[model samples]
Target: MQALTYLEEYHSFKEAALNSRFLKHKTIQQLIKKLPEAFEQRCIGQSHEGRDINLIQWGNGSIKVFLWSQMHGDEATGTMALFDLFNFLQLPQFQEISSLLAKSCTLYLLPMVNPDGAERFVRRNAQQIDINRDFNHQVSPEARLLKNTRAEINPHFGFNLHDQSTLWSVKKTGKPATLSYLAPAFDEALSVNEVRQNAMLVIAQMYKYLNPLLPQQIGLFDDEYEARAFGDNFQAAGTSTILIEAGGMFGDEEKQEIRKYFFLSILSGLYAISTRNYVEEPLQHYFSIPKNNKEIFHILIKNLLHQDIRVSIGLSYEEEPAEQGYATVKTYTIKDIGDLDHLGAYHIYKEETLQIEGPIDIYQPANFTLKKDNMILLSFKNGILQSKL
Candidate 1:
């Protein structure tokens, strides 16, 4: 079947993921109401805010696949992909695949695991518990609901869905917008077990399908077994769980393009599990992509000398919540007197600087005091200059 296209035409991870016109609670309710009788919606539990935690179950296949998303409320990219998959399954063109899969295995989906967090665009629930890290305690309503739901379904294959920061790359060597996965380890020591190996086999096959499209942008996440993590708990329970972390599609202004890739990856994973098309060898190219790092700033001015002391200046961008129309810009403390390694190369002029004649509108650098006669201006892309009076 042709891959599902992203709903948005433009591609920005935050934009696409944050667009809730169709994925909101009301919209989801409407869609669920419209679903055919074959699909069943059950209230698994209540969230921290008393919102119903709903689960939609379809199909009667032997090999059950459980998929959940939005555990981190702000991480909505995977939730978008989940809805897209739902819509795809409902399409006429996908009927054959859907029907076939339905007859062979049950598909359970919890698209919005943290409704309260989603509303606030935060990572934690209303009580501030990270559901992902609450598995052991299961104190949070969302975590308890998930645990109960898992016990009820006892799915053979579990898909723990999430989105990662732009800093993440598949291999430490490739471009951004990479996809990553982890076959949940079965033991607390994170020992490689048969279930994990089987999950890896499917991941290897899925990599074959995604490599051509994503190239070096696909990677494996570290298989650390955290007692509170949902993936680890599920794996420890003997369910083969796959953690899909969508990450780093640079310049994907709307995240629409990345969403499509994520859709394709999901399809590939489903196919791998259903068909048992496990590849024996791991994808070595997975390690070719660069690891994600936060060392680089959004903007940087380099090669500046103050009082004969050479230093590098960096600026990082911060965005306000969606409610805030404009993003507040600020400068933060960064590494100084360092080489260009792991940093942007920007040159600054030794003589030119910013002049302050009156009260400043914004905070000035602590080290560089503003002078009325000295003018600060940026130099040819590489340097910052302080104009001498």
Candidate 2:
């Protein structure tokens, strides 16, 4: 019954979840068997593909908290965190939290809310409807199911969990990943209410628990009104809904570290809600951290072209599974322009060559001249040059 460190715990959980044989449907079933006492299975509705939407309910109390993750099937990071949190709740150390959760607050979780889309690793459901945007129309079965469930429970608080891409980072920051939250505006006026404030309070507390682990990687999401968004709908219903967006972290391509931070944040959030400690202010040290950004490239070359006409070039490489093995595609971007005096007055040229067995061929700018037989390279004597191969 030893406590596992954050990295060890999250890696273990991720490996198991990723290697599971079942799709979303079977995954939910397996989870129920793994934690039968803590999880009660209930039907939400059927997807466009006739898949039964599932719900797992734990704890029965007057104060209800609703948490739904993986509304976007391809966004599996938050869903994984939810599973880890469930496991933590079952631990002996969390017996008090578990007992209080059952007696004081009813925790309702719908993991992998979009099963049809989840199967194909898609953002939308089987009907091509973004569940988050379907709140207003209730056109998609997944959306309707969530709405109905919310009405039935009338939860006091709602956690809309999601994941964002690595391209997004805080403004003027270098952190690779950020955990952001938003207290959805109740109406079109964008006016803040007690419910919104309460959601912020909870978010601020969660930030406190996560900041030490993630530092400047925590952020606040912009609050905008989307009639169909789940958070907006829940906020309009007078429930304090907090939108948690798990984003990129530096050096964690798979986001395993960010996942662990999310698990701890959820635990802190639940603890705060149960104790009504929403007013507790986070440490100022959390604000001193910078945000995440996409400024860095995989490879950067400076003072090219004999160092005369200077230019800072950045090359980014992406690896994708291929029929044979893996294919690496290289993209080039001009990051900066250095001293132009060295090159007198020159122009930039690009050469591209494709080779199946050996290096690619090379061509001059505008394909006017064939420069070399193999290898892709860019020659910039003046101004700036950028291209991809």
Candidate 3:
């Protein structure tokens, strides 16, 4: 209920400092230093590159809830939402929900778990290890620190936040999976114990509240068991782990809009736990949520002449960090060619008489110009979008 209210007034608490997805360790540190006295902030450990991994603690209730984000430096959406939640918790305007959370739950937030990877805007740490997959081995210091922190807290609930590929779409709706949730499976058989089931119930509650706003854009992430992933292990260790992934939106490239929904999701989940209302949610609702599928593309071109045959083309971009991680360079490539008529795309061009001025090669960089009536409509040079005239 409060979440819906917060949705209308999210701008008041949104973290303006983290307006972009290219968040660095220093930027977050400066923001952390400015947190109100209500939040207890400390340096929990150092990253592989000597960046301080900080933990901000709030509330003092019996329910221990641990939320961590940016395990993959590139997935900064969750960290931004966490900061927004921090602002929400500090504001007196929403003191009713704040009071409820403070009285019913204790929140431990670890933002930017992989600062080194974030520094380069890459998915892996400086040692080239995926921290999430290093759980069983503990080879990376960051992974070790995360594991030790979880063991120390032994939290009742865990929120594993990350971003997913923009190409993932909701089944049947053809809408981008802007946000996805999953109750990670602990075992190989994907069995549901009380711990895992509680997570599903919380996700169901979150879905019930979020679906109205997001519609078919919200989807359930795959539940395959990952033995080396933190969420699965945390669930096996008795913490009901809920995974929230921020995916793509049509025009919200920086995820500024998606971050709001992500923030509300966490708030809604917290509301469910604080009020103990998730138990009333039926298990069927969780299963009923749409599963993610790769039925979307960054750009789709249809009814274009290619070798005298009409075809549809799907283009996807590969992003590389640039300018010391301050920005990214996207190189669009022809991921699929032929019949992509059923798939959805962020940008689509479907003209009955469109001509291609260059070669169309599957799995190759996009290097062509699309024209209609001898007028250039779209142009790409070596995978870089040139112009839309």
Each prediction's Cα RMSD? 6.6, 8.0, 1.0
Q: How many residue pairs clash in each candidate?
A: 39, 7, 0
Question: Tens digit of lDDT per residue, candidate 3, span 27-135?
Answer: 9999999988889998989998899999989999999999999999999999999999988988888899889999999999999899999999999999999999999
How close is every model to the real structure, measured as TM-score?
0.76, 0.74, 0.98
lDDT of 2 at 56: 82
Worst 10 residues of 2 by lDDT: 361-370
lDDT of each residue in 1-389, candidate 2, tens digit only: 11235435555444355432123656765775577576787777788888777788888778889998888876667777788877766767557767766787889988778878777666788888999898888888888888989999898899888887554556554343458767788888977777877887887777666666666567766666877688898998988898887876655656666777777677777877887777665434223334444553433344444223444433333323232211212232333344422221112332233122212112211111112365444432221223323
Question: Between candidates 1 and 3, which one is better according to TM-score?
Answer: 3
CA shift of 364, model 2, Å: 16
Highest lDDT against the true fold, candidate? 3
The candidate scoring highest on TM-score is 3
Error of 3 at 78 (Å): 0.5
Structural RMSD, model 3? 1.0
Ranking by TM-score: 3, 1, 2
Please write out the lDDT profile of model 1 over residues 327-367, one tens digit for every residue.
Answer: 22223333344453445312222334433232111223323
- Model 3 lDDT at residue 256: 94
Candidate 3 is scored at a TM of 0.98
